[model samples]
Every structure is written in C-alpha cells, then in structure tokens.
Target: MNTLPQWAELLVSFFIILGASFTFIGSLGLLRLPDFMARLHAPTKATTLGVGGIIIGSMLYFSLSDTLSLHELLIAIFLFLTAPISAHLLAKAGLHLELKLTDNTRDLRKKPEQYSDKDS
Candidate 1:
C-alpha cells in the first residue's frame, strides 16, 4: 500500500480549494455583473478555468493510484473546446437580434456601410 507524500496531498488540496474559489467567484460574477455581455464573460472564462483546474487535480490524484484514468482529461478537453464556441455563437445571435442593454459600453456589431461608386 502506497501513501501520498504530505507535499503531494497539500498540493492536491490547494488545487481543489483554488478551483472551488474560482467557481464561486464565477457564480458571483454571474449574479453581480450589470450587463449581459459582461456577465457572459465572467462565467465563461472563470468557470472554464475552474473546471479545468479541478479536472487536472482529479487526473493527478488518480494517476498516482496505479490504474490509469483519462476521463478527466477528456472532459477537460471537451469543455475547453466547446465553451468558447458556445459563448461566441450566443453573442453573435444576440447581436444579430439587436438586443439592447440599459448600459452598453460599446456597440461591437455595428453594421458596415456599403459604399457606392456614384458617390463622387
């Protein structure tokens, strides 16, 4: 029977705490941010990192146990790949629908004007 070194255990605990804190912060941001775009960024970025960290910690903890486990890595990879795409599509759809916010900082999806040659 092999026991994890004290240092390894401490490291794992630290990662778990860090990941939990980030996820909490993301949830708070989701509630606190005033606007939709700003709110969208908070959860998408922080939660992604938080989940990634937890998954890595789980991978480390399991890898040290002799039996190989790739489930955590696969989940993390899928999450990293999909989260951004989902956010982008949602933002694009919002812009297309001309959703207006009470306090919009800047209009990112301003339509480009078509120039005509007859305009001198």
Candidate 2:
C-alpha cells in the first residue's frame, strides 16, 4: 500500500469533504424548494458539481496510490458529459407536458419582430 504525501492527502480530503457537503446541500434543496423547476436546479447544478469534486478527489487519490491511469478520467468525462444532457431532456419533457412553471421563471414569449434577421 502507498501512502500519499501530507499535502496531497490533505488536498484529497478537502475535496472529498467539499463534495459531500455540496451533495448534502443539493439533497436539502430538493426537499425544501417550493416548486418542480426550482427543485430541478439543485440536483442538476449542485449535485453535478458535487460529484465532479468527488471524482477529482478520487482521481488524485488513486493516481497517487498507484500507477496513474485513465479509469477515473473516463468516469469523470462520462459524468460531466451526461448530467447536463439528462437535465435538459427532463426539462424539455416537463415543458412539453406544460407543467407548471415557477412564478420566478423568465417569460419565454417574445414578439417575432424582435428577432434579428439571422434568427429568422
């Protein structure tokens, strides 16, 4: 078994704690937020970032412990790639169903004349 240097271990532990805290915050937001749209924001943004932190910490820990490899790299890549797409798809499905939007949601309606020629 390999032991990490003091600073590297400290950094890794910090990342892990930060990641767990963000994840907890995300879960709390999901439970306490008033509406669906508001609730969706927590997991998509906070949780993704939280997971990213955990992955980065894992990568650092493993890389320091053994021969550096791309296993953790691939997991991080896949996670960063998929989280947004999943969130977008869920939002689109909700929109297509005409689900209730939070009062704070920006009004999407706009006049056709406001569009630039490039937008037409």
Candidate 3:
C-alpha cells in the first residue's frame, strides 16, 4: 500500500476529528433541545456537515492511493442534496400534526394581519 505524506496524513486526521466533533455536538443538541422543531436544525445541518467532512477525508486518503474513489463523493453529494429536503419534510409533518413549540419560539406561520397596527 502506498503511504500518505505527513501533510496529507495530518489533513485527513484533522477532517476526521472535526467531523466527529460536529456529529457529537449535533447528537447532543438533538437530545437536549426543547422541542422537535427546535432540534431539527442541529442534526440536519451540523450532522450533515459532519458526515461530509469525514467523506472528504476518506476521499482524500483513497484518491491519493493507486485509484480514485467515487463512492465518498457520491455519498457527500447525496447527503448535501437530501438533508434539507428531508428536514423540511419532517418539519412540515410536525407542523401539520400541530407539534407544540417551546414558549420561546415564535410561530411565524401566524397570519400577517396579526402584526398590523390596526389591531390596537
């Protein structure tokens, strides 16, 4: 097997570590957030980026060897494309089901007239 140079090795290690850290933080947010809508942002955004980072590291490591690796790139592309759509679907479903929000979260779905000065 061909060996990676010191710089490449360091870069790969950095990506892996960064990815793991983000995944961990995202998972923690999922568990600790007050409600479903509040929690969705953490995993969908942070965790997706986390996996992307690890995929990038894997791609770098493999591409530097005897052959190019397309699997990681495909996975990263699929993930980037799907995460937002899936999160939106999930949030839409939650809203349709009338999922309750924490008191601190304002419901933007309210009718615009509710904000009018005429109400006073």
| Top candidate when judged by lDDT against the true structure | 3
**For residues 42-91, what per-residue lDDT tens digits would candidate 3 score against the true structure?**
99988997998899889989988758888998888889999999999999
For candidate 1, the TM-score is: 0.83
Q: RMSD for all candidates, in order, please.
A: 3.8, 2.6, 3.2
Predicted candidate 2 versus true structure: per-residue lDDT over 1-120, tens digit per residue: 989899999999999999999999999999988777678899988888888888889988988889786787888889889988998998878767777766787535335466546655
lDDT of each: 0.80, 0.84, 0.90
- Tell me how many residue pairs clash in candidate 3: 0
How far residue 93's Cα lies from its native spot in candidate 3, in Å, is: 0.7
- For model 2, the local distance difference test gives 0.84
Where does candidate 2 stray beyond 4 Å? 107-120
lDDT (Cα, tens digit) per residue for candidate 1, span 1-120: 567788877777788878888888999999998777777887899988888888877877777755767989889989999999999988888777786665554664453443434554
